[model samples]
Target: MSWQQTTLGEIADIVSGSTPKSSVPRYWDGAVAWATPTDLSRLDGKHLYKTDRTITEAGLNECSARLLPPGSVLFSSRAPIGLVAINTTPMATNQGFKSFVPRPELNADYLYWWLRANRRQLEDLGNGATFKEVSKAIVSRVKFPLPPLTEQRRIAAILDKADAILRKREQALTLADDFLRSVFLEMFGDPGENPMNWDREPLSLQAEVKIGFPFKSAEYVEEGIRLCRGANTMPDRLEWSDTRYWPVSDAARFAEYALVSGDIILALDRPWISSGLKVAEVVQADLPALLVQRVARIRSSVPAEKPFVFQCLRHPSFWSYCNPTETTIPHISPVELKNYPMIKPPRELVAAFGMIAAKQSVLRQKVEQDAKDARQLFQSLSQRAFAGDL
Candidate 1:
């Protein structure tokens, strides 16, 4: 099939967003869905139907921002850029986006996926002294080969089905997350209230909080032992993507940094974000991994203590303890992390809760495996669809 090579500006009107005055009370909180890069970053779906904050009519009138119609593709332009989403309803955005209002010839879903596929290239085009930003002009100049209008819609439809599958898998994973949280809550009576009046203690008292080895980039090897960094810590589990390795010879020197099964790990930096938890317990499969810097390993005093502490960190109530400072990179230092309070129940109670947790975890693992299979299918379909092979 033949494709048309064209710049984005040729197919859509690129509009920049602007923020209304924050100090004006009249301009704040109204019916208008006003978005920001932050909002787009947290979006789990392809379409943005509502925003965390709304604006008044006066806010719309007072600023240069336009009321984007449905089907407009919103793309973040600054402060960690290249997040893309489509507006399902009429909306407005802060100055952090350069939105594309698709023309009659273009399908918004097609444009959304195209932008996502080329996000790395788009992000690389950004330039600024303070923080990277891809200007409206830069965005408009992005050229790509497009199929005919009918083909665009057809391709989008195929991709949408694949995307829907991915979304369902994501929903399943989220449900699994919710199930774990629910189990914790039911067994442990809110950690915030400590209703059981369990003994309050510093995390350091019950665990060996050891920071990872500060290995330089030069220390990385092609293959030897897996190194778990801050990025590897996911919500209640470890993620193996972007796994780095260190020389086996150095293993003796960094033996203390080694992780064993059931060790609870936490990302000392940016521990909490709009995304879920940055803490997890090391599973058996993730054994023999070395803890890299900015990640902390919490070796429980006893095997039973592992599940208790891991669940505590996973609790929503623990978010208040992980402070996001005013600095450019938010982090909780090892000193501060050690001081995090935990309510400890009796050994017998914790052991019983751990049994229930093991059963629930088995269910979660099955759902996760299904999600993994679905994700792989979606990724394969997405590649074929984009390559005109769908």
Candidate 2:
């Protein structure tokens, strides 16, 4: 079968949205969901359950922002391009979005998947001196290869199944994280309670905590060391791609601060945003890597006890203690981290918690592996489908 290339305008109609006047009380709050690009980052799938802010019917009438029906593909065109989500609810978005309402003959899921696969092409079309943006005319003119409606639906179904499997694994990982947090809270009581009933120990006594080396941005290379930053530390994973690198000399200078077999790296800045800590084990070939200035190195005194500290840092009680006083950034300084109190249980009980954490870690590893496999499978399918080999 031969594939025909067509512009987005031939497949769908592009619509822009506007915000209602803020001064009008009736326009400020209502039942309509008002979305921004920031909201797209948190979604698990095409459907969006809620938004940070909502608007009233009066607001909808006051602005160009009209209610987008279910299945409309929403793309962030300004600030950043190609962040896409299909509207599951009757919603209106900010100016940052350029929504595409697909023609009835075209499948919405197919359009969403196709656009996502061709995101780089859309990004390349962005034109602006100050801020990169995809104008309606530019978006409408970008071409894409399309398959028959049935084949499009089939390809979408395959991709959807793969995505669903990955999402389930992610959900399982989230549950395991919650379980670890619960274990920490149960082991250590509320902060207000006296430390007499529990063991009290300084972090210095429990682990080898070290500050990261300060390497200037000019020292960054294309590829050398796996440099970690505040943004690299995520909830359950460390994003290593698109990372800045360090020179061999600076990497050697920061070698001592390099992550060891059982070190937990915690971001001192913006700790509250992610409860900012990531506990990662150093795998083979990860040596000579250095932590960025915003992060700290935490090595447990005992190898068996490292996971316990990882769990402790994620506890809500820890955040409660850290959030009381505001700093320049939402962070816990090194002094604050060192002085922060912890309700220590008996060593045997701590060991038991570590055992449970270790088990959770194994389960999480399996889930992650499954998710990775699903992603690879989806990528392969996408290539084959687009090439008419599927």
Models 1 onward score TM values of 0.88, 0.87
Candidate 1 local lDDT, 1-390, one digit each (tens): 467888999999998999899999999999999999888888878889899999999999999999999989999999878899999999999999999998887888899888887788999999999999999888888886688888888878877887787788778878876776777778778897888787888889978899998888887899988999988888677888788888898788888899998898988787775567688888788977999899999998777557778878777777777776678888878887788888877778788877876777788778777888887887787677667887
lDDT scores of the candidates, listed in order: 0.85, 0.76
The lDDT, on a scale of 0 to 1, for candidate 1 is 0.85
Q: How well is each residue in 1-390 modelled by candidate 2, as lDDT tens digits?
A: 597778788988888978999888889779999988888877768767678889999998899997888889889898788888988788999888889898866788988888777888889989899999999888888877777788889988987887787778778777877777777667755433644477667676777778777778876788777787766666545667667887765566666767765577776777554234443454443454678786777788876687777666665566666662466666667876776665566778778878887888788778777877877887787777777787
- Model 1 / residue 259 / CA error / Å: 1.2
Best by the TM-score measure:
1
Clash totals, every prediction: 0, 0
Kindly report the root-mean-square deviation of model 1 from the true structure over all alpha carbons. Answer: 2.8
Q: Indicate the TM-score of model 2.
A: 0.87
